[model samples]
Target: MNSVNSSQNNLLFTSRCPEVRDAQWVCQKVKNTFPHISTTKISAKMADIEEANWDLYRKFIDKPEYALLYNKNPKDRKFLRLFAWRRRIVKRIHDARESWRIGGKDDYHRVNNVLGQFKYDKLGNCGEDAFMAATILRINGVDNTCTAGLKVDGSFLDHMVCVFNKDGSTFNGKPNKNTIIIDPWVGMADFASNMFQKYKNVFSELLIGIKPQSEITFRNVDEVGISGMERFLLIMKHPELCYPNSAREFMRKK
Candidate 1:
């Protein structure tokens, strides 16, 4: 990892780092467009951000297919069989999307990762939420703001979050005791320890059938090799690589 750090730094500087560039664009846009947000107290700003319902994007996109199946006769055995088959097909398509590898076929169902686009689309999953939150914090003068990824049970890279200095101090990669974590996906922001306790319950619910053993690890986007939009899409598609792991785990449990 140490040997790659230099190249990583170079990548972060050159055209290879569109994610970083996009984040900067978001910060600048927020600063220019929403200057009032930065003038408010930090707590107030965070609370205002918490009110946003961006997770609706996921809910909207994930609605099951074959809604007409629900209108079929409940008493008919054939209808039941066909409905069950439709459900299986829906689950299979979802699983295929989740398990898609980086170099596999192009993913047309990519989540909105371009942070600047969030202003207009108001649609995104955890990655977009984290990206926007971290950039907003920076625009609001939290110089230590960092977009972090979470690995559950030591393997599944299934969540994204924003970490920043609680006392408004600048720092490098990762968070310390002085840092606070803001998870826009769950609409909560608190000190690191408190946030994790709150998030554990939510995580358990989100990843049904896979009980997390309290093993949560965080990594900055730079450390994960997600340097561009294409890489971000690949990461987002796989539960073991990015957000919302429930479907994959549920299928595995069955």
Candidate 2:
């Protein structure tokens, strides 16, 4: 059974999806063209690459089969309990584990922070994708790039993305015009101020009854001060800590 599962996973990864291929192409193109660019040009070009990665990821997940399997529609809650949904979800989780294990041998149980591993596998949910996007930005000389996620009432809201502090300004209660957010999961990258509006207009279906910016605390993963392995173990033990929201509490307890 293990061998059969491994074979199936190998086929899944070996046969590159079109979206994954396109994302890799964009990454390679950026790497090739980046060296000849000026500082100002580099930022714009890097944004394009980040946007392209986000677009491809969106395409990958928006496919009917994939979307239906992971449907979040409130009306689908009953259907989700059905064996068909359970089987598919379980299979996906298994596949993700296999991919993570093979790609991240050094950190098998932790999030794959190595860029090469992510590029090779091209399979992860929001958190991993956010980490990949932030790493890409940093590698290309972008500063203050970090993974950020929302927290409400001391619990994580199950979303994360790459945030760029373009002007090194601290985020207070209000959105800063210079704050850029790149969400590969949702296929958007814009100023934090503009993104708040887009969150309502564009991502309303996914976000649903969006919380006010003041109520939503954006936690940067870098500030968590825990090793990836330790963070992973903490989340495994206290699943509430799986999201970025629980990081502060975990630190406080430490």
Candidate 3:
């Protein structure tokens, strides 16, 4: 394993940060958005969810966790979906988006800190978005399970994505088959519904999915725009690369 200090110094202009700041941010979002939720004990209703529920997911997320259809799940489901990737999913995601800002929305989000780029293009910070998304969902009631590993088709490297589930309460008990994965960056609520007709839609599986359509846009870490979701349909339609173990084979891999 690599020392956290050796990760990178891309954001020398920034100050020190906590290892789990992202997790906290996620929790914050959940609290703010789902004002009605007071740590309620939502019975694990994985069965209530169906294949058509994904459309509702887009409305909750104001910006980007870059979540995909498969990523989001109830707490119980996250465990069943995540195998070895569970222990560090929350940590890795929070760390991935750790950084400082440089400019404004007009300017592209520059790298203040980073470990590796998915394709060397900047669409705000993917890791931060995922961390924020997962944290918010976890706190609000959605159980998000993710994986930090190589993609099977040589489309990308050192990647992470959420998988949905039926139940999502870690404190309740052992893991269950209630989680599923989603790429937060894939869908933009601002776009026409038909425009998003293609591209894998995985929101329907969860009790609730969040996307703030009115607040969707790519963010510039430096300026007045610290909030927004940059649409990257190009990612799913055409990924860069993946390893021999694609997500579909995640459980069966040797």
Candidate 4:
């Protein structure tokens, strides 16, 4: 049944959904084209353009969750520190493991839907976890993307990771000038160092980054050995996974 709308609950409904969707494209454009752009500049621009349309989006940006998640509250700065390594960040991951359930096999869900279940103290697989982390970072004015890769061949995603940019010359215990790979589930930041943590040699290949401006495309994702009924059930349960195949041929090319 359709529920009555009030100013308190109508913010999301009255706001144009396409505006937020297009806002993603705008953010992606900034990230891919000018990765070195200042976070303050990006945040300001997004606030002017996107925030005008979605009040809830703006509220999420101004929230103190980033500080709480990192266990550091900077009075002067609005956004969290980039690539700032804090002990509480790791502790948060470990604590989350205790509350979030290890979801069933092949149970993929979108970031928004997976986040909704969080109120019930439920969790999803690696992909869901990575996407949720990426969303939080994005809301906190951090540029991030959800990445996926295959295990071997004709198999589901072997692992998922969130990629972001750090302004300084080093991050996550690496000499990266920009890119930093973060695995929210395992609390691993450096992929080169944590190769064996999630899966042995998972990053020995390439994985497409799902960012706002990304144009990566896929075909025949359902070519796996799973039966049609099983695949249909999985898709019905998690419609986001049915949108486009995450696997890319670049891994095989490498």
lDDT of 4 by residue, 1-254 (tens): 24335333433531333322223332343233212212222333444544453543344347646533654436322233322222234344445544443552332323334444443323244454445545433433343333443232333444555554444221232223344444544434432222222233342222322223222221122211233454455445544332223342211111
Instruction: Give lDDT per model, in order.
Output: 0.45, 0.47, 0.28, 0.36
Mind sharing the TM-score for model 1?
0.43
C-alpha lDDT of residue 52 in model 2 = 54
How well is each residue in 50-169 modelled by candidate 2, as lDDT tens digits?
465554335333563564457676544333333243345446545655655664543223433333334453334566556655544443334355777866445666777667555555
Superposed on all Cα atoms, the candidates' RMSDs to the truth, in angstroms, are 18.3, 20.1, 23.1, 20.3
Q: Which stretches of candidate 3 lie over 4 Å from their true place?
A: 1-123, 143-150, 154-159, 169-177, 188-254
Candidate 3 per-residue C-alpha lDDT over 65-163 given as tens digits, one digit per residue, 9 for 90 to 100: 333234566752443333223224434434433433324222114212221222222222334334334433332333333322222223333223323
Angstrom error at residue 37, model 1: 23
Better of 1 and 3 by lDDT: 1
The candidate that wins on lDDT is: 2
Among these predictions, the greatest TM-score belongs to 2
Name the TM-score of candidate 2.
0.45
Ranking by lDDT: 2, 1, 4, 3
User: What's the CA error at residue 175 for candidate 4, in Å?
Assistant: 13
Tell how far residue 45 is off in model 2, in angstroms. 34
How many steric clashes between backbone atoms does each model show?
0, 0, 76, 0
Candidate 1 RMSD to the real structure: 18.3
Arranged by TM-score with the best first, the candidates are 2, 1, 4, 3
